[model samples]
Target chain A: MYGWIWRHLPGNVYVRILISTVLVVGVVFLLFQYVFPWAEPMLPFNDVTVDGAAEPLGTPRAGGAA
Target chain B: MALRALVRTLSETCITIGLVIVLFVVYLLYWTGLRAAHASDDEIARLHKQWAQGPTGSAPAHEGTAGGTRDSGHDGGTTGGADELAGDGGAGDADSTAPGHRAGESFAVMYIPRFGGDWSKPVLENTATATLRRGLGHYTGTADPGDKGNFAVAGHRRTYGDPFKDFPRLRPGDPVVVNDGDTWYTYTITARPYRTLPGDTGVLKAVPEPVDEAATPFRRSGRYLTLTTCDPEWGSSHRLIAWGRLDATRPTAEGKPDALTREGR
Candidate 1:
C-alpha cells in the first residue's frame, strides 16, 4: 500500500523520498508529544497504581476460601 | 528510460527506509538512554545539594513540625541532634504522602551493592516515566521505607543507566537498602522475583490478595518492599517484581548498617 502511494507521488525519486520521510517523522513527533500522553489514561500502562487492589493468591492452602 | 526511472525510484525508497530504521534504533536504545542518563545525573547532583544544606531530620515536605518528633528516639548522643540527618526513628511517615512530595523530587537514595560498590541511585517521589528517568521512583500512596506497609519503587530496567538491570540476580535474603537522608532502612528479599501483567495492581497492595486485614501494616505484619521494572529487558508488556520484608533501621549517625557492611551479598 505504501509502495503504491510512493509510486503515485509527484517529483523525482529523491524529492519524493524526502517528502515521505518528513511526513512520517512529523506524524511520529505529534503522536509522541501529544497523542500518547493524552491517551495514556485510557491505556493499560498504569492501571494498578496504589496498594488497594489484590490478585487471588489462587494458591490457597487446604480449607482456604477462594 | 522508463524502466530506469522506476528502478531509481524504488532504490531511493529502499535507502530512505533503511535510514529511517537505523535512526529509529538510535532513538530507541542510545538516544533515550543518553537523555535519561543526563537527567539522572542532574537529579543526583540536586539531591546531594539538598542533603548538604537542608536541615537534617527536616520535617516531611507536607505537614507536621520538626517539633512533632524532634526527639523520636535513636538520638543516642547527648550532644543533641548535631551529627546526623534527623537521627531519629519514629513514624516519620507522617508526611510521606504529602502533596509537596511530588514527582521529580528526589526523596531518598537506593543502594544496591550488586550494581557496584558505590551503586547509589536517587529515589524520586513518583514512578511516572519522566520521574523514572531521574532515578528509581517511589509509588505514591504506599508506605514509606520502614513503615508497616509496602514501600514500593519502580525504575527502568534497561535504559537510563539500567538501575535494576541486575534485579534477577537478587536471591532470597539479599539486602535492598534505602537511605532516607537520616536513616538507613534495610529489607531482605523475600522470594524469587514475581511476574505480573502491567494492569495487575494487586502486587502493589499492602497484601498481595484478598486484602488480609491481619496481614496489614496496622497489625505490623505487612511491612514490604517492592521493586518493579519492565520484564524481558526490552518490552513493557509485563512487569518483574522483587518483594522484600523490612529487616532493620539504623540511624546514619550509627554508621553504615550491617547490609552495607555485608556488601558481598
Candidate 2:
C-alpha cells in the first residue's frame, strides 16, 4: 500500500520524502482528532456509569449492596 | 511477478494496519490525556471567572425550585438537618449558589485530599461522554452539593486525564471537599471503595444501600456524596464506588476547609 503511494508521488526522492512526512502527519492528525474520537464510545474504557442499558456481567448481584 | 506483488501489498497493508492500531492506542492513552488536561484546566478557569463575577442569585428562582423537586421525594425528617446547614448564608446557600444546571456546564470544584494536595477538578453538571472529558461529571437528578440526597459524581479511572486514577486509594474517613463558588462542603468517606458492575445504578440512589444491609453506610439520606470510576485502571468491566457523608460546611470566604488545609489531615 505504501509502495503504491510512493510510486505515484510526482517528485524527486528528497521531495517525495518531504511529502511522505507531511502525509503521515496529516493522516495521524485526522485519526487522532476525528476517527479515534468517533470510535471511542464503542470501546469499554470510558463506560464509568452503571446504566441499565449496558451489557450485564451475568452476576445478577454484582453490586453487592442492591 | 504477480504473486510477488500480491504478497508485497498484503505485507504492506498488514504493516500499515499494525501502525495505525498502535497509533490509536497512543491516542487513547496519552494524547487523550493531554487534550483532557487542557480542557479541564480551561473549565476550571472558566468556573473561577464565573464565580468571581458574583453570586448565583440571578439564577431563575423557578429553576432552583425545579432542581430541588427530586429531593422532595425523600423523607423530610433528614432533609431539614442538611437544609439548615445549607441554609446558612455563607455555607448553606445551596439553592442560589449553583451557576447553571445546563448539561455539560461545570458548576463546582472538587478536591480529594487523598488524591493529592494539588488535585482538584471542575465538577460538571452531567455525565455525558463528552462532558466527562472536560472534568468530573455530576450525575444529573442527584442532589446538589450540601443537599439532602446523594450528590453523585463520576470520573474516568484511566484516560481523559484520569481524574479518578487513584480511586481505589480512597478509604473511610478520607475527605472529598467541594466548592460551589460559594460554600465549601466537606464530606468524609464512609466506606472503602466498593467494587460493583456498571449496571448497578442503585449505588447512586438517595439511600445507596438497603436498610437491612449491615454494610450500608447510610440508613436514610441526610447529605451524601458518591464518587464512581471505572475499575481495574485500564478497563471498565466493573466500577469502584466510594460513599461519603457531609461532615462540614463553610463559606468560601472562610478560606479553604480544614480537610483541604495542610494541617487538617
- Any runs in candidate 2 off by more than 4 Å, and if so which? A52-66, B57-100, B210-214, B263-265
Interface RMSD, all models, one decimal each?
Answer: 11.6, 7.8
lDDT of each residue in B1-265, candidate 2, tens digit only: 9999999999988998999999988988899899998998898898888878887542343223322322323222222323332332222223322334776788889999898888889998767788888898887767677665678898888888888988888889999999887667788998888887776787777778622255577765467898888877877788888899877766676689777896244
For each candidate, what TM-score against the reference?
A: 0.66, 0.83
Model 2 has a DockQ score of 0.34
> TM-scores for chain A, candidates in order?
0.56, 0.71
* TM (B chain), model 1: 0.77
lDDT of 1 by residue, B138-236 (tens): 777666665545778877777556778887787788888887666677778877777666655656656553133332222333457888777767655
Q: Residue by residue across A4-65, what tens digits does model 2's lDDT show?
A: 89999988999999999999999998999899998877777787776641113221211322
Give the number of the best model, judged by lDDT: 2
Best by DockQ: 2
Best model per TM-score: 2
Q: Model 1, stretches more than 4 Å misplaced? A: A1-66, B56-58, B61-100, B210-220
